[model samples]
Target: MEWIFLLLVGLAAGTLGSLVGLGGGIIVVPALIYLGSFIPGLDNLSPQVAVGTSLIVVIFTGLSSTLAYMKHKTVDYKSGLIFFIGSGPGSIIGAFINKSMNVQSFSLYFGLFMILVSIILMVRGKIKPLKLRSKYNYMRNYTNENGLETSYGFNPFVALPISFVVGLISGLFGVGGGSLMVPAMILLFMFPPHIAVATSMFMIFLSAVTSSVAHISLGNVHWLLTLVLVPGAWFGGAFGAKINTRLKGHTVITLLRVILIIIGLRLIYQGLT
Candidate 1:
């Protein structure tokens, strides 16, 4: 029965995660929190286990999404590599922070923190039509099938800081970091939503890999369940990448905001009760 719960959570989270560029960790972490409370011996370790397991699952989802984006030439590998150069070390620092923090405090603040971040992104995301005041006008030149390319000009100044922040969050929370990275790329870098999404997945793959390794070193992983979740998440990721081509940027952002709000409220309610 418990195993059934795990499997169902994996299936539902994987499908939705792939569809939303979340890498499934957002869903998996909350579900673990909700379920672990009911298990006699599982409560104490649930969050760590959840984070570790989700990263393992994300590894598969990220790999599949990367392949799909590569097939379409949608990924900006150069920019992603540059971002990872900063993110890799940030993730390690974040892991140390997570290790020292108290879980109770983390849980109490997690949803509220994410909600605030989501609101900022939601408001900023509405500025799609506004002209960017950037020195690099070249970011407006590249074109995709949907014309979602960033101008050819790259800005490491903004990208570097954003990458470091997102990596810290990824390592701390076991999130895909897409929620932060995608929005940062769009607003700060003035990257098109499509390009932002693809690039986020690339960064997430690196973050997940590094974070997972650190978690594993601490003996936090659930190998059996990770195996079950990975294969399914891979397929789901491919499906999401394909569907993203069909969705409009505004529509995707609207939907993502709604989902985050709902999750945020749920977490707040849980914490309060």
Candidate 2:
């Protein structure tokens, strides 16, 4: 029953995470922590251990989703690369720092962070898109695999700091940087929704790999539990990406806002109690 519960949690987290460019951690970490209370053996699991295990799960889930988006040529490698550079090192730094934090305090901070993220996401969702015709005179241009036109322009320099911060949080919480990166890309950088989601998965993969290695060295992960979640993560990731391809950019943002609100409230409750 525990295995089954974990697997389903992985699947749901994987699917939604991939779709929203949030890796499984936002959902998975909370699931592991809350679900642990009901699952016989997991009840005693530590929050750090839960976070570490979620990172491993995100590694697989992000990969699966990235590959799916890559197939559609939705990924913007150039832009993703810029942020990737900042996030990788930040992730490593965050991992080592995670070693010294008090668990309960960390949980409280993490929950507060989630609430903040949720509020920001909702506000961003409500904001009107800027008319960039005058500003972005030199339009970036491209076509997708089927030769459908797709293009957008953003300053990479402006994005670096945001990416580094995203990575720092990701490494610290085991949540994929996507939770922040996706919203930032859309709101701050003006990335098209599809492009932002695709690029986010790629970046998450890079950050998670480096962070996962750090967690392993610290002995923070639970391998057997991660194993149980792997299959579900992979399948969910693939399925989510497929769905993402079918949805409109606005629709995706709406879904993301809703999920963040739910996750943020739950985390806040957990922390408070």
- TM-score for all models, in order of appearance: 0.84, 0.87
lDDT of 1 by residue, 1-273 (tens): 876677766765555555555666776777667777775666776567777777888777777888887887778887788889878777766666777655565675567756865685577646553444657433535577756544643567766777888778777777777777776677666676666777778878888899889988877687877776676678877877887777644565566567767777877766666
lDDT of every model, 2 decimals: 0.71, 0.80
Regions of candidate 1 where Cα sits further than 4 Å from its true position: 1-5, 38-41, 117-121, 129-141, 146-152, 249-259, 269-273
lDDT of 2 by residue, 187-217 (tens): 6656777788889998998899989898898
Task: Give residue 174's error in model 1 in angstroms.
Answer: 0.2
User: How accurate locally is residue 203 in candidate 2, as Cα lDDT from 0 to 100?
Assistant: 91
Scored by TM-score, the top model is 2
Worst 10 residues of 2 by lDDT: 129-138
Position 39, candidate 2: lDDT: 78
